[model samples]
Target: MTGAPAMTDSLLAVWHAYRLPILVAVSIFFVTLRVYTQSQSRPKTAASSSVPVSPRGQSPEKSQKLDAPAEKPIAPQNPTTKEIFKPAPKSVKPASGPKRVQGKKKPAKTIGGRRPSNEDNDNGPPVSFIQPIVFFASLTTTTERYANAFFPPQLHDISYIDFDDFFTTVPPSSSPDTRYVYCILIPTYNIDTVLSTFLGHLDETHNDFRIDTAPLANLAGYSVFGFGDKEEWPTEEQGFCSQAKEVDRWMAKLTGRKRVYPLGMGDVKSDAENALKDWTEGLLDIFGDILEYGGLGEGVRGSGDAMESDEEDVEDEDESQSGKKKSSTMVDLEDIKMNGDSAAPLPVDFTTVGKAVTVTETAKEMVPKTSPTYTALTKQGYSIVGSHSGVKICRWTKSALRGRGSCYKYSFYGIKSHLCMEATPSLSCSNKCIFCWRHGTNPVGTTWRWKVDEPELIFNGVKEGHYKKIKMLRGVPGVRAERFAEAMRIRHCALSLVGEPIFYPHINRFLEMLHNERISSFLVCNAQHPDQLEALYRVTQLYVSIDASNRESLRKIDRPLHRDFWERFQRCMDILREKRSYQRTVFRLTLVNGFNVDDEVQGYANLVEKALPGLVEIKGVTFCGTSTSAGAGLTMKNVPFYEEVAAFCVALNAELERRGLHYGIAAEHAHSCCILIASDRFKVNGKWHTRIDYQRFFELLEREKADGTPFIPEDYMMETEEWAYFGKGGFNPDDERWFRKNAKPRPTHLIPAEAQAQVDAHVQAQDS
Candidate 1:
């Protein structure tokens, strides 16, 4: 025991001296062994095992010896090419740039070569085939007016491609190396418009599962600028430039997130100019970048999460730069090519009321499939045919089909109202008439610049539309099957539905098309275009609307667009006077009370004498309650009563007698508040020869066309029915008589003393 204690004491003394050094050595040895084992177990990535090289990309063997390690370095698998050029993350903006986006130091993409990116796309090889195309759509000419003032001549020159050119299917680049950039200028409309059609097309283009998700990936990029009415829409959330935002989203998806700039929105009434300018500057920057980089630049530069905004969309590279990013700007006025000339882009052949007009080489659609006007008209029981013509079913046609009374024409001119198809060859006019009921939906142009639908096209289309509309009424309660079948034949055509028929360039052909099918045409003119009136072809009956008696009153009633409207009006009267001999010319007077009726007896008498028309068809104004008519100060009070119309016709007849004109009251259709005054030549055997012989009229027309056979208005005149004479109600006994429901009583003081007895009889008949 004594000896063990001594040995332990010696061991303890040595342990104390070397304990610290011994512990340090043990820790170091364990750490080195653990580290070496962990290193051997770790996964070897390409980046980790990649050969280290110098800054100049030269192998390290040239400078220093690379001693081989104990274990062979894991050979890093080669990355596929797709992984090298994979699409960047969504958050990435352009990583590269022109470094010359100011358009000053950098050449445009189309003009010269650009710097190469990491790889060569189809548009690369030190040069780019970037084509920036501009597109626009206009309705009220506001968009066109702005585009004319805003876009550059060269850009406008290559711009104005039809929406169908690319909206449905992306057009392939001219070459495999080429790429396109669409710069769209758009307008916002609440109503269904062509822009709506375009948006729908975009929607379909992307949503269609049959097509590739990014079918337009070949496109270099796209941008949009929108025009909106701030007074109405106020903000994008409320629909201001909503279409443009939608376009941006779809285009981004279509082009594989290839948004060139940002979405621009401009308030037409407010900050459009400044907004468009700012947007244009940024767009110019992108153009410069495209020229230099041959793309919108890969990774990301000046990009953000694609988003919407109240006024505009702003983009950024990342969340850190969100606040610093520029807001999306307006469109149109500033995105013109920098080729120097700043001519207007021709999206269509239309001009604003006061802008300089440049006729396009091709005639464009006046009422395109996307126009809001088309929607309005279609909703108003009208079927739009071709580009401009429209066919509608008149209430008289419906009434006649139900065995109710026909229109006044049937009582006086012997037309079966149900067989009369109402159609117009043109849906444009030169007047905004106060009494017109069109609701301002029709286009008003001083000239005809729209596409001319072929006469046969209009003819076939209108007939089909009319027949189709008529067929829809087959299940109605009171439709007579025989009348409906007869209606399909279209015996008579009233070319007076909502537009100026003569505005059509091929009016004669349209009329001939009618005549060829044995359909009689009753065409009415607004009496504004003297040239068209003079060149008018033979019609069964041609009526000139004598809206007013004098120049000032005519202006008040017609609201004509031409500066020399009065001169044109007077010229139409002279032309009518010449046409009265061969053409069945009639002066159709619309007496609007408080505007053109009071104290205008002598003035109308002067017009009648000036034209010496075959007949004077005077009717009270029909109230078409619409905002446009209300804007012109028209109201229900402006519509004259039947008694007032008759008294006015009486006074007019007396005035004609005083002027030594051979005209007298021949017939009356009090239901429509209308009366016909015939010339002495039609007063055969003390009876009115006012009605037309339909077959004879057609034969005369065909003879005239075939051999230049001359004919007169009296050649086919037939005797008027006895019930259509003066003082008769002009109701067709074969058809039932009906009155409007809840109609109000009218004053009788406006009636002439002699007509009071007849008015009392009519009142008694109405009471019964």
Candidate 2:
């Protein structure tokens, strides 16, 4: 206690000496504390706002780093876009524009490993429209032309653009409401091209583990079209349009099966222009669907799998995992047999297969189920057989079934139209004939590089397909039970459908199969394939389509694809000269009014003198006023009148006689605007015998096959019907008259005089 008092007294003395200074320091300390407390208690003012405000999921430090006024993105000319995810350092900054060049500032929810589609993203601003980006890679400029023909806003020449812009991630949206869609037009090369480089990038993007597998799933949809040299690589197995197929598959995976339309392919040398146009029109229709309904149309989505595109080297997880694929619309029964399935399917389905079979999955078909050509042919009422062959119900057969009348064939050759099957083993032709009903819709090529279907497969498939179509016609208004029963037997195979039948590699075998089945073969060819014509098998009758009388006229009318098309045609004439002794060669002339009908008689006679065909069939051109014909300058006036056709036939006959050719007008089918001239071999006892005894033809074919014995067409000759003789109308005795729909009672010789005169003058000038 005494020590404490002593210390306190010393302290008191010291405090007294420093009392003034101590009191001042104590006051300053309390004042500073009060100021700090007051500042802390009060709300922040503008001056105290130096601390960073954190984003929802970010730390304050990171938020502060982001707080720096973002260096306005230095967009270069043609900026590479990856605006959805910040995958690279370059993407860390926002995209440069308010046009949604950058995605929304906030993150999007990932569902099933990808951003949800516009349909699933109701929580965000709705997608208002679909923005299409056409991507193409061309080697020889053919594919580039097709790309330009596509809907506008294309990035043609993928070589000029950065692949990372598209393949790396989902594309940046133009606006929050604008969804992206890819329309790709690619060409395939046997050798590597920039297209191959693009494919490599696409494959890398799909397989990269760092990115989501379906990173592009946010896209509305995608489709692809391809161009290839059909002459060099006719099928996808040999690399025709192969790179496009690869892109399609990769995009399917990347977009989570958002394929808007099926893959389409065209031949660079033949029909790429028309085929690409058709494909674009179809995509536009689908785009309308996406904009209005906000999705790929029903059942159209999720169809871009391995099986839909004739894909090779792919395993379908959906079918493999499930061990069974249920398809209510699969119509290719061969698929079951090809896959060794014990169960049989319904006999004839109107729908095509939804997925390809195991065998077809490993190679490209001439016409894939998903191809636009297949769709168009089917729409035009063709029953596709196997991959290449097709069978269609002929209007003449319909007429016969209705007891209206048989076709011109029945009048000229004495074969009942009801018992004939109009079909072709190959649907690919070498020409786009202006008068062809299937010219604009069918596939064309200059070679036979596609997969070769077996003769048995084609034979059996075509028969069934033909019979099925005939059965479907039973429901029509026509009623003739007796004729319908005859139609079921398919006594004759008329190989005169949309394409050159001889183009099929196994054409001879197909003919042998037909002959073995007692079905007579009547084959027609486009004369552009002389080698095939030389190797053709014996048929009930053989016909060469003489579309134009001269080279210039042929080029304009037929549009042959061969570089030496005229030479090939003349080669066919020589081959016919060699074939006429044994085969019943016929020259079938299709007289186009303004294209081939004026002053072509001399030219036709020259070809006749060279080939010396056993018979010359002259017929007027017939088109149903379709857009395809319209595009080729055909109109109602282009169809020649029956009288004009007869006059031309008479003129041609007179020219042949002047050349000392022993041909005489034998038969006419006035109702159908057809006439026939036969060599004197068929004229006996001053009577014409142009018709063939089909039974005798089959017998002779079988005999020749069995004993190595050969027979001439004359061996199976039969007398022509009295009503089918030259001055007669040639309408069948048991049938009623059938006029064209909406045809006036007057004659149909309404060809435009000016067009004919123009062609005549041009031809005369060319000759001079």
Candidate 3:
């Protein structure tokens, strides 16, 4: 009985241990089942309540709209805890409140105004005179309305006050009582203070004078004048002054009244006293007998008899004033005087400017001097010296057609001095092309020798020579007196006046010296002197005369001196590529018909691609001077028609685009010449049109000396006047016949008769 009891107790202990493990297992299973049922059934509950179920793969966070009725089933309640855990079936509530989709959200509201269209932005500002005046900050709507009323079109002939030129000081009682009304309009920074001071002065005035002051808008038939320094006026004040809405509203208020005349004191550069004196005189001229001791309402002291006497006095005063005004109008003579003080007599023995200058010696020594005959003429007084180098200088004289067009005739200076030197300073070049306008001389040597004359001596000699030339031309007929005076003023230097300056060994140093003297140098080179070109100092402009298209054609047309000239030409182009720091490298292509016209476009494009010059001047080859060798046939016949030339430029632009280059024609002389710009930067309407900044052209030149590569893109090297010349290529050729029929032979009126004749002959030949 004791053994049985012990076994039973052991069995009971084992049963108790296993009972706890089994209970735990059962609790875990029920919990797992409850979680699984809740997850699956929650979505069913949502579906039964008319909520769209999310797709199987979609996250619950992403709410999607119900496109079609979903076929989800309602979850059954758990059987074990039906009463405790079961959800009561949802009862359909009566339609109440606002109906809303389960997950859809309302869109946000747009603030401010709707977006503006492109056209609205493009039409930015209105086009009106008042608008521009406001834009310049010269007048505000506050003042503009007064100006319009005072200067109304209906009162055009009526005398009005010119406050800008009037009221020098308080008038004396003895002064003639002319009917003139002096209206002084002042725009003071301290308006209130100035007005108070003016009122005090008026209050202290005698019975002979009267004064009145009114707000700008109410001041009808009154003159207006602005007084404020541009620097003094802050940007905010200027903006307020230029408000168009304010101006228009003011004008509307003064609809019937005479508008106030507006003027500014800043326009004239004179002391306040002088400006006031001038303004008073102008008022006297406008009003004759109406001026009185007091205001306009006061009767004249002197009656009709006084009018006659006053008229005589007025006429005399008017004459004196006119003479003084004319004298004042003359340009300041001191400004015209040569700025340089280094003047010296010529070394030659010949007296009188004309006899002292001679080109015969220079012509003979051309190979040594590497200077043209024109330079010698300038030294002899046949031309005026404006700018100079050791071997060359530019001379200018007034045109016989006084001030009608470009009235300066240019010539070369210093050729005679270099020629007289015995060291053989001249370097002769070959290639007497038909386009050349200089005297054709035989070629001599390939190199230069001797130390050239100093630049100072050349300048002085040129200047003296120029004065002498004008004195000689003074007696000549058809010359205006003004032109003769203008001939004495030398302004510009053209280094490439006649021949290739590159041949001179001292050419580089000469250019450097010219630059130092503030003389702009324009050097033209014939590709023959590639070596010399390589060693050249980049001047204001470096022009290469591209006269032919292909090597064979160039040989035939250019008649080069060296057999390897073509190779040297290409080499020169390559050198130009290396000297990209030079901002004004220009490839001047002389266009000729029946020669290389057909291929010139392509040839120019290729060369431009290689050289990447800053500009390209495609001009007609002038048939003047020695070029008369070709005469009427080659000279006249080889000129391209303006239309054809324009077309060719268009095609060239197209080619430039194909090569990934950006180019535009800068200038056009119609049938004569067209300039193309290749720089990445250019200007239009006072704004930059390209990536290149022309303002930085000089700056880049300074910076680029250390690194010769062009900071600008290579492709933007050839810009042509395609739009102006061809007009997108659809216009009728005869639409504008003026250029072909009546256009001037050349755009430059300063070109000599011989040059003009050559250009005319070329154009006529092309037309024929």
Candidate 4:
């Protein structure tokens, strides 16, 4: 028994020493056994096994290896014959069935470890034949703008799906291949969040069929292009939004190489057209030969004349007349050759582009009103007055010409609608206000970025643009010939067209040119640049569009690009107050229904008291089209009604009274949903003097220039009698009696009695 214990102890020591190595060997043996078992038990699906490779594409040895138990790979019966490429059959799935996705496989069974017989697939190669291309646009406008830019129907059958409906229409089971690439167009703004949401949905559905089996990685196969305003994506480092940069980086990482092209947003036809060309070029790079003729065809073999023949055939068919529908059926070479050269090819015309086959064209039909250049501006209903200048016939101008109504400018400042020329010397602005009717694509700049056209050129251009516009209405159904002729005369120039006129470098000279032409100038400034306001000379009336009453409100409403814009605006107001005694100043408030219309009484009063504006025009914001910026989402409900505008005016007037200010509500124009509050200084002997005395003002300017004396605004001021708001003496062009009774002679009938003698002398001297 003692000997047995000693033996056991020795055995235990040996066991301990070998235990580690024994455990390692056992683990290895078990792993190998499990792997072998798995290899035997795994099912041989068609994708991984059973499909035999053709000897024509692979060596016999390789083919044998692929289908180890099958017979020798079949060789062509005719060694000298070349494989003829055949067109795929037309996609025939019913509307309710799963779509024919690119790279998708047709379910087929193996015949004794060999691929389906050649006769089974009509002697075609066992490859998926359909290629589907889809576009996921971030905005309706984006899709509309770029729909025809890439994948013109002549070359590709592209489909568009709305952002909301895309996932539902295209299931995760849909496959993609080298022959089929998809596109996802997303706005740079908030793209990170959008992609995350998209990927989360894919993961929730357990979609692992896509390329690289990762959501973002799948997008690597797509050719991406982005277009937006530089300001809209204003990050100095990337020259685009930070989110856009992240998307670019993600694409680069996923694709491992390809770069995204950035096309700066421009309000011109060429911008969209050029963006499309760029996208086509990028696609060409990605797809290589697949984009060329015969690339997508199967078994396309041979060289020289054979390939040329196919190209010639395609070209001949493409030569069909514009708008002609071409058949998708493949034309057989023998059939085409049999037709002979005597059969003239259909006349080829590529000018007429077809509309998108599947999507609604409503978005496409809405052309953006704003543009970047004179020519494009003209197409958008503006008259390119001159270099960097344009004119457009206002709705009020049309109304007055038809004897239907007049603009608020007419009622408030006695500006004859027919005689006023709505012109601007600059088409760019410093602010991108949400309520602006101008397209977001319009150019934005804090300073001049282009060559300045001469003042004379601008003047002539304005005249020509205005004349052309007026001529078109000469024989209009409702237009009065007399009024139309008067409109052609162009007595007044409202430099408040589409942009900040003060930004025009030659603005001062432009005003002088207008005055010299005996045309009164009414210049409008956005008050973002104080220096521009300080240098201003003479104008019949000057308007500062005060979009917001407070600094925070200003930033939200105006969306000014300048960091110190509020400071500059305040300085501009102070300058206006300084020039109050020298020039007529007006503060224009564009009240939005949901913005800047609440708790602004004191703010408005503070500005009024500081600037002492001759008049305050409180008008409601007009919501039109759609907003690209989510923050600027506005609807018809966001447009305040006339009563709301009046209520706001009443509140402002009450605040002014509380502060003992002299401004009071002077008039209301219900049609425009606007109210005018005027300074008591605009009244003479308790009578409102709203109508401008153009003649006296012009005479005074001439006298000041001839005598080399500084002109004071009060020197030529005239007394006024208040007109009825809605009765006999009210300002309504429709009511001939009131208009006729209230209408004063053009220019200077109200000159002070004391200045009559001087005015007569000056006129006599001028005639001599």
Against the hidden reference, what TM-scores do the models get?
0.56, 0.55, 0.38, 0.53
Give the Cα error of residue 385 in candidate 4, in Å: 4.1
lDDT values of the candidates? Answer: 0.68, 0.68, 0.38, 0.54
Best first by TM-score, ranked: 1, 2, 4, 3
Model 4: per-residue lDDT, tens digit, 307-376? 2234433543676755676543343566554445546333221211121122222312111223223334
- Greater TM-score among 3 and 4 belongs to 4
Using alpha carbons, what is the TM-score of model 1?
0.56
Model 1, position 57, has a per-residue lDDT of 13
- lDDT (C-alpha) at residue 184 in model 3: 33
For model 2, how does the per-residue alpha-carbon lDDT over 454-530 read when each residue is reduced to its tens digit? 98999999999999988988987865998888888988889988888998878898888888889888898989887
Tell me the tens digit of each residue's lDDT in model 1 across 470-573.
Answer: 99889998889898888878899999998899989889989888988899999999988888888888889999999989986786577665657888889899
Weakest ten-residue segment in model 4 by summed lDDT: 78-87
lDDT of 3 by residue, 453-474 (tens): 5545554664465455456656
Top candidate, metric TM-score: 1
User: Which regions of candidate 4 deviate over 4 angstroms?
Assistant: 1-376, 385-387, 626-631, 716-730, 733-768
The alpha-carbon lDDT assigned to residue 398 of candidate 1 equals 90
